[model samples]
Target: MWEYTDKVKEHFLNPRNVGVIEDADGVGEVGSLSCGDALTLYFKLDADGRITDAKFQTFGCASAIASSSALTEMMIGKTLEEAEKITNDDIASFLGELPKEKMHCSVMGQEALEKAIACYRGETVPKPEGNIICECFGITDRQIEATVRDHHLVTIDDVTGHLKAGGGCGKCHEDIQAIIDQVQGKPMPIRSEAAPLTNLQKIRLIEETLEREIKPALHQDGGGIELVDVDGNRVMVKLRGTCAGCKASQVTLKKTVEAKLRELVSKDLVVEEVRS
Candidate 1:
């Protein structure tokens, strides 16, 4: 479950401008039910090219509905340029703040607005032209790169939360990981042999990787890590300082810690935060 602000609750419970305009000047639709969220936006313009009315029909969770409602309210009386200037961050800010996992709702709203404006201009909705990477969500490489650049996303989980990539099937995890690495200017993870290892060997290799690789990287960000135990393929560790309480601890644990261990120790390795 995610924490929602009171404003978010209000908008979702009583979403303004629900339903669509029968004769809208601009209409945009985005997302799909399979992906867990979708939004359809409509806007009408006045003689002077100002938005006179805006409405939405959303099929998603509470956050998605709130985002659509907030978007419509934000567009009233604004020119297309002004509406275009409104970003996902702007939508999030309008309703206080959204939980990290729910950021995609605001992003969906932003995409719908862009498509709607494009429709008004008699132009095709500008989609990022690239091969589809996340078949589960119909996300493309260009979409992933754009979101990573826009949000400064650093991990696969962050990308999943924002774009729903790597959230399903688990087959696209590696691909999403590669995209994150490329966008962040990091080298690819080195792959090694997947041979059998004794428990003692596994423990030793995990410790060596933590000290020689993971800790230094985390320390640079004012964080620390410690090995607690190694039970079979599961490596339980404790995050120290800022990293322990940070909302992005899951991302750090998976993308940084587990990834490093997998490259150097065993491909079957799984990292878990030993939360106190």
Candidate 2:
């Protein structure tokens, strides 16, 4: 677990502005391209153009969730201008401090807030425009280059966590790996030397496995699994339906599916479960 500050722990445990507004004046969604974190913000405006209410739903790590919660709490009752001025620094300050590495998570919340305010004011939030680079998180060449040059990104995952480009769908992993290779002037391997699996190939294998081996067994218990990614022999998967919050998930992963994968694939294959 992350060594969260008091503020982060407080907000996370009793997260403020957690639900959605029925008659929201505006809604905005921002997701980090690298870190697999996403947030959706909803707001209700008053007659005086003050933010009457705000809420957020976050899908990410602790910092991302806590940042989104803190951002919503800070924006409530603030005027549009005031909310617009709320920076990443302000958010981090509110939380006392955050891990330097998790600073980007707070920044994501600030960016989302800005986008939400822009949407409320009928301003055009500029869509990322540049050569496509990281297909996983839809990160552009400009975003990657800027992050590399300015932020001193040392690894592909670091770039992904900051920009959110190669953190999703797994389609851009190879491209991102290539970019990291170019940036470092040497290859940095994110995957092992196992035979690579294409999206289609992985999908087919997962579907076949689920249909023939896993799903039928899970159906009996009203549980299921979703295959998220296959990086070399490292298979990333998500528990879904009933299996998600089940207490026995670890047992299922370690004793059953992971065991089967290791037996079928390379013995070196490692199965990792992602918490949603």
RMSD of each: 13.8, 18.2
State the lDDT of candidate 1 residue by residue for 205-275, as single tens digits: 78867765676578778888889999999899999978999999999999999988888788888999898
Candidate 2's C-alpha runs over 4 A off are 32-35, 145-158, 165-276
What are the Cα lDDT values of the candidates?
0.88, 0.74
The list of candidate 1 runs beyond 4 A from truth reads 186-276
Q: 1-276 in candidate 2: lDDT tens per residue?
A: 667899898888888888777788878888744446788899998899999899998988888888999998899899988888988768888998877668777778887887887877799788777888765455787767656544445577777656666665767777666666555443223334378667666556655554445654665577877778877767788887788888998899888887766554446667889887
Name the top TM-score candidate: 1
TM-score of structure candidate 2: 0.53
Candidate 2 global CA lDDT score: 0.74
